[model samples]
Target chain A: MKTLVIVAHPQLADSGTQQFLKTSLQNFSTVTWHVLAPDVDVAAEQALLRRHDRIIFQFPLYWYSAPALLKHWEDEVLTRNFVYGAQHELAHKELGIVVTTGDAKREFVAGGKEDYTMSELLRPYQALAHKAQMSYLPPLPIFQFAYLTDAQKQALLVTYQQYITNSDFTSFHGQELWFEGQLKAKIDQTKGTSKQQLTQILTAVQDNREQLEELRWTLSLIKDNEDE
Target chain B: MKTLVIVAHPQLADSGTQQFLKTSLQNFSTVTWHVLAPDVDVAAEQALLRRHDRIIFQFPLYWYSAPALLKHWEDEVLTRNFVYGAQHELAHKELGIVVTTGDAKREFVAGGKEDYTMSELLRPYQALAHKAQMSYLPPLPIFQFAYLTDAQKQALLVTYQQYITNSDFTSFHGQELWFEGQLKAKIDQTKGTSKQQLTQILTAVQDNREQLEELRWTLSLIKDNEDE
Candidate 1:
């Protein structure tokens, strides 16, 4: 599915987290990066939104919401007639949020310092998705990006890539397929022994995925037999 | 307490509900109506916020949240340093929301068309209040102002007045005291038989209040004895 990542940050140039995310998506032609401007062109935005199957509002959390720029775009572009009106151009599309926060994830709980979960903080967007008849994706929260180690950052990159491009991001089998596809593409460009090692890794991934699928099928049959 | 009603409507003059609310607060010298401009003066706005004991963000609900203008004001005016820095000016102050929606209040529920409660939808503001160390008041949602009958409007006027002016806005005793104070003032301004009738009504109100207070005292004594 085609994805639109609508970046809404005032200091876009200054944000290292945004820059890292932008660079990671460079290889995927399926992903389109649309950085929001303060001045909104309602028709153009609506058209862009219409073109994409998955619409992601990516921004650093400001006062537990999107920066005003994105809110302005929503206010101006997602007009009543264009959203939930009889036409309902955005119906059945996916609405996803990618929020970056300076606070640690643990601090966003009932008794935590923030005193609310990311889920609670993001209800407005869920409500928005409900009103427009769009499927709301679970939010991808990148918490304390600056504090993450190199290994953690690498993991985050992979998760972010899947969040943006993978249609079945929630499924483990789909993730394996996505990883396999990426490795296969990388192996194609490589020459020599490294390519052979990459191919070995790809084979293992494919073998594991097949075995898992077989196990899943057998498990489903067993469950059905038990029900009978 | 001094209350600043920060009106944040893109089309303020056009809203009959807003106009009605504005008229209701015309007599209260303690209430200040500060309509937000698109161009927010951060320093000046912060100063205004500092001056008020109660800061209210009043607007029509857009996309199940406050309008973009109010969100914009929040993004800019409420600076990190000013709000939560060394000296937190907003602490112990009250943060109030006066949201107007075109939808019926019933529609904002789990099984309703909207599929979320107003409290769930307005959590962003509550989070903001938490961050600012402000006391978050229960929101005053004015749903479908155009559909309200004359008596409903009058009742709304009284409630709105209490929301802005009455210190004990949440308690029945506070409401009684507020009404008594208003009636006594009205009685002093009247003349002749009307004055006598108004004085009688005020006396009845005063007597009822005393009786209630005595009853409360007796009930508390009974509870204390039961505890012993």
Candidate 2:
């Protein structure tokens, strides 16, 4: 799919995470990068958006949110008639957000100074996606890149390259339930399973469940602590 | 107290509710009205903020949230070391929000298309206020202004004036539990209420709670019906 990445960072030259991601996507002819500064013309932005199939808002999270210019772009480019009231201009198009956060994943949880989960922090964007009638993708979050060693940064860059180029991204909606159903179906597909086969499948499912539970528990604990 | 009103409508001239409020506030010598359009200089904005005791963010809700420019202002003006991190510049300042919602009050509930109450939608601002160490005031919601009759609009303007000018504004924050323990001791002497009279004084507290619950339930019901 033709992807339009709207890169919004005040100082891209100084942004290691953003620069690395942009450089990685440089070889992809299908991907168009629109470097949006605060002074970008509104008409030009709207025109650029009209030509794209999938729109990705790429930004460094400033004070737990997108920088001012990106927010300004949303206000100007997403007009009432086009994005909301008239309907269908953005319908069926995919909307994605790629954010580079300053803090570790733990700092975004309930008790952290940020006082909200990444999901909670991005609810406004989800609401915007709903209004625009676009299919919202799960955000690609690069956490604590500022603290990463050079080797760690390279590893993250590799992961990011894989993340962006992957064609069959899992949809964000009801993800857990969908994955669970898939796992059950896979288990059922094995007809006349031996004890060994059953044990293997069960082990994989148990491992997946354990990982999911750990993530869920950590998030819940953070949320509970935040409430206090 | 000096009140700084940051009017954050992309097209303030065309906005019915915002225009009316702006016109009504023209005679108030104590109120410093800052019209924050897309073109506002970041440095000038910060300088203006430093002079005010009370800061009010005025906007029309777009896509169940504040207009993007308001978010832009938050990102740009509420900087690190000033709003947070360093000794707080906004610690003693009172922050308020005045929102003109296109959706009816009934349409902002649990099951509605909006799927959130105004309070829930406004959590980010509250979190920002908490971080900034500012006294967060209850939002002044001008609901269904498009449907209001001329007489009703006039009455609303009067209420708006009272809300902005009232000397006993501390009472509004006093009713909020988040502020109760923190601010009650300091203001209790002024309230002439003994410790024994706290229960009797909490009648207003109970009333505010009931109203908030009613609003939440009504919004949810409206949203549920809208989808059908």
Docking class of 1: high
Give interface RMSD (Å), model 2.
2.2
Candidate 1 chain A lDDT trough over 10 residues, lowest sum: A83-92
Tens digits of lDDT, candidate 2, B1-228: 788998888788888777788888886777988887765577788888888888888888876567767777777677787787665888878888888877788867777766667876776777777778787888888888989999998888866765565544445442354324323543454445554476455656667767987897999999999999
TM-score of 1: 0.97
Worst 10 residues of 2 chain A by lDDT: A171-180
Per-candidate TM vs. native?
0.97, 0.69
Q: What is the total number of backbone clashes in candidate 1?
A: 0
User: Runs in model 2 with CA error above 4 Å?
Assistant: A39-47, A171-228, B26-29, B37-47, B63-72, B167-228
Worst 10 residues of 1 chain B by lDDT: B78-87
Clash pairs (backbone) in predicted model 2: B109-B219, B109-B220, B112-B223
lDDT of 1 by residue, A41-127 (tens): 888888888899999999999999998888888889998999888679989999999999999999999988899999999999998
Error of 2 at A76 (Å): 2.4
